[model samples]
Target chain A: MYANRQWVLAQRPAGEPDLDCFELRETDTDAPTDGELLVETRYLSVDPYMRGRMSEQESYAEPWAVGEPLEGGIVGEVVETESDAYDIGDLVTGQGTWGEYSLLAAADVAPVDPSVAPPEAYLGILGMPGRTAYFGLLEVGDPAPGDTVVVSGAAGAVGSVVGQIAKLNGCHVVGFAGTDEKTRWLTEDLGFDAAINYKTTDDYQAALADAAPDGVDVYYDNVGGPITDAVFTQLNLDATVAVCGQIAHYNAESVPTGPRKLPQLIAPRATVQGLLVGDFATRFEVATEQLSEWVAAGKLTHRESIVEGLSNAPEAFLGLFAGDNIGKQVVQVAAE
Target chain B: MYANRQWVLAQRPAGEPDLDCFELRETDTDAPTDGELLVETRYLSVDPYMRGRMSEQESYAEPWAVGEPLEGGIVGEVVETESDAYDIGDLVTGQGTWGEYSLLAAADVAPVDPSVAPPEAYLGILGMPGRTAYFGLLEVGDPAPGDTVVVSGAAGAVGSVVGQIAKLNGCHVVGFAGTDEKTRWLTEDLGFDAAINYKTTDDYQAALADAAPDGVDVYYDNVGGPITDAVFTQLNLDATVAVCGQIAHYNAESVPTGPRKLPQLIAPRATVQGLLVGDFATRFEVATEQLSEWVAAGKLTHRESIVEGLSNAPEAFLGLFAGDNIGKQVVQVAAE
Candidate 1:
């Protein structure tokens, strides 16, 4: 037996979740059962999708009940193993509880190579966020060479990689971020042709028209609201839009309203498709391998706005709504 | 030389077009030019799409300038011909002016056989609206057996056919219309599984839930407004929406606002695509052949709400906004 510290849902959020919604409490874990591994959590992922699970609304992911321990992607070291799939002290990544230790099934977790990237990367660039940007952009957005590709939430985990992958496909990439620093990182560091600070920009349509003179052929939307409405106005003929996330309205108590866009789509005949990364589970290996190669060759770069300590995991998750993270936001629960 | 009466755009509309927006005037037409045919208009099509041309807004179709004579689909008798492709007294259909007589290039018009259907049928079920329903439903909506296909404007020209085609595809068909008569026509005459009078129904979501208990698998949206918002709520996983038209917003002075629908799409991964029938020009023959066969075999039925004389053309056009016509709306310019 081992002592553990875990975070549980204390109460449901009415709008934006606060620290009061989460309660960290002491717990105990049993030894690894057959086909299981006892792992000590090193890194925990705090994503915007977690907001959906906190509510009772019907969504692709199951909602978490009050008093239930929160579960998420975790990078951990196997402390004890009951299966040959993982040896003791081996680093692995899988869905685990928001705690210091988790007894996860050996078949559920995959071994991570520390040589290719740091262990925390498995919870970010080498994980769900990376695979989402890959298939969502290529399969749904389907940008062709010279096509103008626009990304909302351009500084977030998925949008940052979406813009870079579009560049590799020989397309003109434009991104919408919240801050001047984030926009600069996109245009200067990530090779985005142009970036807009949506927070400061008064007229998104005018800004987008000036940025994409040829009009946008592909739109990968992470932040949906006024930013998305403006992009819809500048869509080129046969434009494709991939709806990945809508962090802007995630905290709204009621459904938000915006300009009706179906009329605008008729003239350009644009297509909008919603996507979830879990749907591409079969093709995750292909994305992981390609993303790993890009990282190794210095072609793709990733940044993690990591908050230290398991107790701060709730804050890290709330920061996503505040646009506090420049890249993938992760919580460092324990040192390697 | 021939004396002709035609309708011209007197002024652009501020909101909904009124009788004052159109002016009927007498004009003179010359003999057919080298490659032209002189056609005496028999049937003129008055469609909802013509409303777009009357406005200066950028749309798929070119906007008509003030004082310009409107042009649309016409079924006429070719009295004078300059090409061997057409003979004198041939019944034909093509893009022609609203005047009694039009000089059209031989290559632009197609000869219509009255034996298959009436010459005016060439303006409707055999023309743009029929082809619009075909490709829009099959190619874009892609409904399969056991799927629940919902159509807005279900009593209108394009939508009536869309629901029928969906029925032929072995799918459950539901439609939303504005009146009790139209709803009856859909469920009883058109073989729709269920129909809702949106005007009488205050809670569209609840009405839809009762109609499509399994949720909507394919939505062919011709009227975009509250009905569309309700449909977005009940979308099944991987549903497809073909946006063919938006008559609900056609008369609005400014862009209309509605509940933002992108977030709702994420959970079901639904696809919303805009479609214009003109894009399927190359496959018009295939649709015409299939639709004609369906009509002749009594498997497909069509009704025309025809207003007598060319003078009522503007009234027929304006009546679309009021939902006065149940099926294909046309103006009978002359006798067959």
Candidate 2:
């Protein structure tokens, strides 16, 4: 047996989780069972959603247990296999313990093609977040040609992909990010028609209206709160808002208050829909194919902030709440 | 020429619009031209939507002028006809002025079958409000069998029909109304599975949870402030909320602070969509046929609080804001 360094939930977080909430310990790595494969994790995807799993609140997924392994999406190689589905050295990605090594069912892990794209990409633009931005915006948001599409948290993994995909769909995309650098990247690099620095802007509604003169036809909300309130005001008649994530209030001690204009939903006749990527699990292959094609054709681009070492995984995960990561934040476990 | 007594919008009100906003003046009615039919209004349907039209605020329909007659859905007799499409003594319904006698294009008005249902029923259950409830609930809410549907202002015009239609669609319909009598009507007369008296119930959310243990699958929101907030907490996974109206908060001096639980949207994967009957104007006839069939089969029932004489029109119109009308509030202009 080898050593497995795992991070367990020590305490439930109040506002933002710190290192005290997570207890990192090294334990004996288990051998593959009859239908299981042993994987030495090469990369761990530190996503914003992990914040929800750390809490005892009613969420989409079950909360992480105290003294148990914290789990998230991981990309690794099969060190040993007890099933025909996976072989030694085969690259795979699946939900795994936040550790250096993990033993998972062969069926749970999906093999990746390294020739088309890098292996790290399976945890990002070609994985759950990518598929989420793909189907959620296109399917639910149903943006038309020349329609103004606005995205919040524009510099993050999902928001970045959402804006680019919307641009590909012939929509005039606008984005709101926290920083000037992110805003610059959104407008100058990501092909976003306009990018608003929400932090500096005094009036978000005014900024949104100035950015989108035609009114927003599709709004992909990643950072909810005042930003969402602003976006709601500029919604065109029959506009569709894809509620993917609410990163803003995730770490809040108390809920924020604003102008409750739920009545505007009637006047403009807009649609506000919440989306979870797990619902589209069956369509991963289709999404990967389409996203891969775009990436290969140089039509799509992705960014990753690689935080080195497995011990720093919890910090990287917590950093998501503070908007520290520029893009898809991934923890590098070992050299490929 | 006949003298036309018109009700004009004199001024905009701060809170609830009073009779002072409308001014009664006499003018000569124009003769019916080529394709015009002179319809002597018998039943004038005064609705809550007219309140919005009287204000200078931007809306789907244009604001009423100070010196012009207030118009709404009206059923009348073709007293003097000048077109091939209509003949004298034919009973018809069209969106017309509040005046006793009004001129309408033959193409704009449809002949009502007095034999199938009463002429007054044409202005209530079988007319605009009925069709509005039918399409708004079914089209936007898309209530599936065994789904729990919660409606706000459940005893009002559009909402009463909404509950009945949902019940017919095999849903467990729950409603929130202002009075005990209306609540009884919703549960006893309208066949609603449950009813919540908002005026009596201090905690609506707790009451709703106690009433609907299964959680709400469809929320047909007519009163969109606190009642809607209560419903928001009880929303199940993949729930759909149809924003038909928000009469409760329409007259508020300032925007209220509602519970900001937008984060729950992601966990439940809910959808809130706004709907307007005018958007589905083309398919109204199809909706009317389905509604009429339901009413004929006794699967659906409706109530209309009728006011006699055009002089009581302002009072009947004002009654809408107070939730005084049991179902459709119509003003009788002339005897058939």
List the candidates' TM-scores in order.
0.99, 0.96
> Backbone collision count in every prediction?
0, 0
lDDT of 2 by residue, A12-93 (tens): 9898778999888879987998999999999999888888888887588888888899898999999999999988999999
Give me the runs in candidate 1 sitting further than 4 Å from their true place: none
Give the Cα error of residue B64 in candidate 2, in Å: 1.1
**lDDT, candidate 2, B139-258, per-residue tens:** 999999999999998998899999999988899989999999999999999999999999999998899998888999999998888888888887899999998888887777666667
- List per-model TM-scores for chain B: 0.98, 0.97
> Which predicted model would earn the best lDDT?
1
Error of model 2, residue A105, in angstroms: 1.8
Q: What share of the true interface contacts does each candidate keep?
A: 0.89, 0.82
TM for candidate 2 is 0.96
iRMS per model in Å: 0.6, 1.3
* Candidate 1 lDDT tens digits, B1-336: 888898999999999999999999898888997889999999999999999999887678899888878899999999998988899999999998777988899999988988888777887788899999999999999999999999999999999999999999999999999999999999999999999999899999999999999999999999999999999999999999999999999998888999999998898999999999989889999999999999888888788888899999999999999999988998999987
* iRMS, model 2 (angstroms): 1.3
